[model samples]
Target: MTLLATHLVSRLRLKHLRLVDSLARSGNLHRVAVEMHMTQPAATKMLQDAEQLLGAQLFERRPRAMVLTEIGTFVADYAARLLRETDSFAEGLDNLKAGGFGALAIGAIMATTPGLLPRAIAELKQRRPLMTIRLIAATSDILLEALSRNEIALALGRLTEPKDALAFDIEPLATEELWIFTAADHPLASRESVSMAELARLPWVLQPHTSPMRRLIELTLARQGLGSLDNRVETTSIFATLHLVREAGMIACLPKSILVEGVARGTFARLPVALPNQLGPLGIITRKGETPSANAADFIDVLRSMTAPGEELG
Candidate 1:
């Protein structure tokens, strides 16, 4: 058992796991080496070492493909899980040394920041004042990619469709209804609600065309047979949109969260238009089968509590 343990320790080095994960992703040893910034020979040797320790052939070296053998696939899966857990453990230990309860790295889309995330952060800080929190504001696509790369502990944003590809455990936090918003003094704001036809006639402030929100908005408008409006202002800035809507009287559709406080303060008004809930469900997404940092998990729990039914949003 002692010899076996030593052999296993030598095989499960960080370099070995990195090689295994890369090969599993690319299915090519040369590509894995290139991605890891190592020579192909070194990568080949690492794989050989790992396979020898496990006493199993991990790959079938076909001319056109480096396919995983049954055992190889299993080992790769387990290796990925092991690496994730090891990272979480290391982070937890670092937090202990720093005299903090734990560290949380979180990503949030712009729309979520105004209400959803602030509430979570405030609650977390109040409870775990010593904990370290890192917040990143980005678009959904950027946040998702960062989450996949393990740069952030978790992401808070609209749930992605075709959920299978997300490969995460998602806990729904809130479902913010979409609404058309404009400055309180805007002509359309005077109306209790505006028609979709009327909405399409105004100059619009919108997210960039590449965004999922923009695509969904366009599709919804097209389905209604409404010709596109003058998209004179294209931006990813939620604050800019809010300001534009409040001061410039430009029309923009946004999740209720973004304008909640502004609407309450009479800076903006929600149009009484029957807009479809273009806003998707908001949720916390974490890599599946991986344990999060204690602080991250605790922060998520706090967010869940704050957004629970009957809880008031500040």
Candidate 2:
């Protein structure tokens, strides 16, 4: 058996994962030891034991702070997820006794937040009022990681690249285009048309560097000779971007679907600029080779049914 496989035997315990999680989160042995209510030496020995059990060093000891090895990241990821699920499972028991079904925790990209998911959520609530529904809105990569750790039952996000999509069983939903949106009162709101150069001159709030949306914006900037944007802020929250754009007279390049409601409500306005090569496919990403809980499965069915006939995913 491989070292990872070997470590998955009866040798590993929950405490080992806790140690890994604490170390990853704190990145300082003394601090994490204090958090775990153990001496520094005991924490060090526990880390060493965990490394030995796994046949690999989970962290690299540095002068100032410790850093996780690649394997350590996996350990921490699973550890955090295990804790979340454990708490939810405890809640599940009480819910079950109260005539409630199991929970369906969903992780989704911002693009799905407004148009697709709300309708599906409403339908699920009406049909299964006893089901506990939870949501974690984040970028696609974050959603994928959560799904992988079984932290979430379903994900609605984009598969921007080839490598990341392989981990999930993705069902094609619909293609959504990115748009440059601003508050209706902004100066650019009344422009007949705008170009990348013109929009780049305005204050902006962009997505985090790691997000696919930001990646696309970066690529577009590079092509348009707008490197090193005058970014006012960087965030993963669409709501935050909306707030900034509305109050601060800033611009945002985000999914068209997310901005539609705001535009229809006259809170935000889409710029007339044309973006090349900025289309993203939105889809449903489920755990590979695993079945979700019955309510979650039913929610998935609701999502599929809610999609318009052509946009319906397989």
Candidate 3:
């Protein structure tokens, strides 16, 4: 290294950096001295020593305040940055020692949003009030995509493709149940039992063909000799499906958890027809080779505890 660079790397110390950073903020020796718990003369001597070592005048002394020379501003700015980074490193180290005190971004399918994920998140927040959490509510495919892009640290959703098994680490959480819902006033609402043939003939509000729920419905119907749905409105939004089921008198096949409020409110009625196949197990998905962040690991622990009691996915 050059002589000047060697002098800086070898001689510059934390105290020198702190004093310059303080000077940049206060612009007065007396205040900087008081803040540093040092006398004014000591502070002045330190600054002079720094200037002499650097072979440059760092500040212009006036009657009232000290103004930074051009080079002093650059040096002080870098010193301030260094101090900030040092403080951040110290805080993160402390948090690591204490456990679970950082930011976490997680994604979940709509099925988990109503009950399962919320309870887990609330419990995590209670344990770590200073933690920052970002929740993304989306479909399983979308959640998987977020995981691939590193947009989320982990996901509570299904694996949409066979290849996902190779790319992500999965821990099965709970199996989701599919239910048929209709408006309370629909013709089939009061029936004790409905034949699959009869139900297949009715208008339906369904998710897109690509969604897992939709695929399950199609597969189940095909097994029952019902070829495919002809009269259906395709939607990915829960609100839109609910509206169509209630206002348009259409049948909707949705996760059991999402219909709790509507069923309680008398806006929706569950049909008597039972699906032969249960949906795939929902699980935690994270990048395969990477270690989870401290906050991610802690949040995952909270989620696992909630699911450990045989709590089915809501």
Q: Which is the leading candidate under TM-score?
A: 2
User: Model 2, 67-134: lDDT tens per residue?
Assistant: 98998888888788887788789878788889987677998887777767888899999988888888
Q: Which of 2 and 3 is the better model by TM-score?
A: 2
Question: Candidate 3 has which clashing residue pairs, if any?
Answer: none
lDDT over C-alpha atoms for residue 263 of model 3: 85
Each candidate's TM vs. the true structure? 0.65, 0.82, 0.65
In candidate 1, what residue range of length 10 has the lowest lDDT sum? 305-314
lDDT of 3 by residue, 68-176 (tens): 9999998887787677657655665675677647667799988888888889999998988877677888788888877776667899988877998899988888877
Ten-residue region with minimum lDDT total, candidate 2: 305-314
What's the alpha carbon RMSD for model 3?
13.7
TM-score of 2: 0.82
lDDT of 1 by residue, 7-108 (tens): 787657887877887788788888888898989999999999888878999988888768889998998877776777677668767976888776677899
- State the lDDT at 263 in candidate 2: 88
> Given candidate 2, what's the lDDT at residue 49?
91
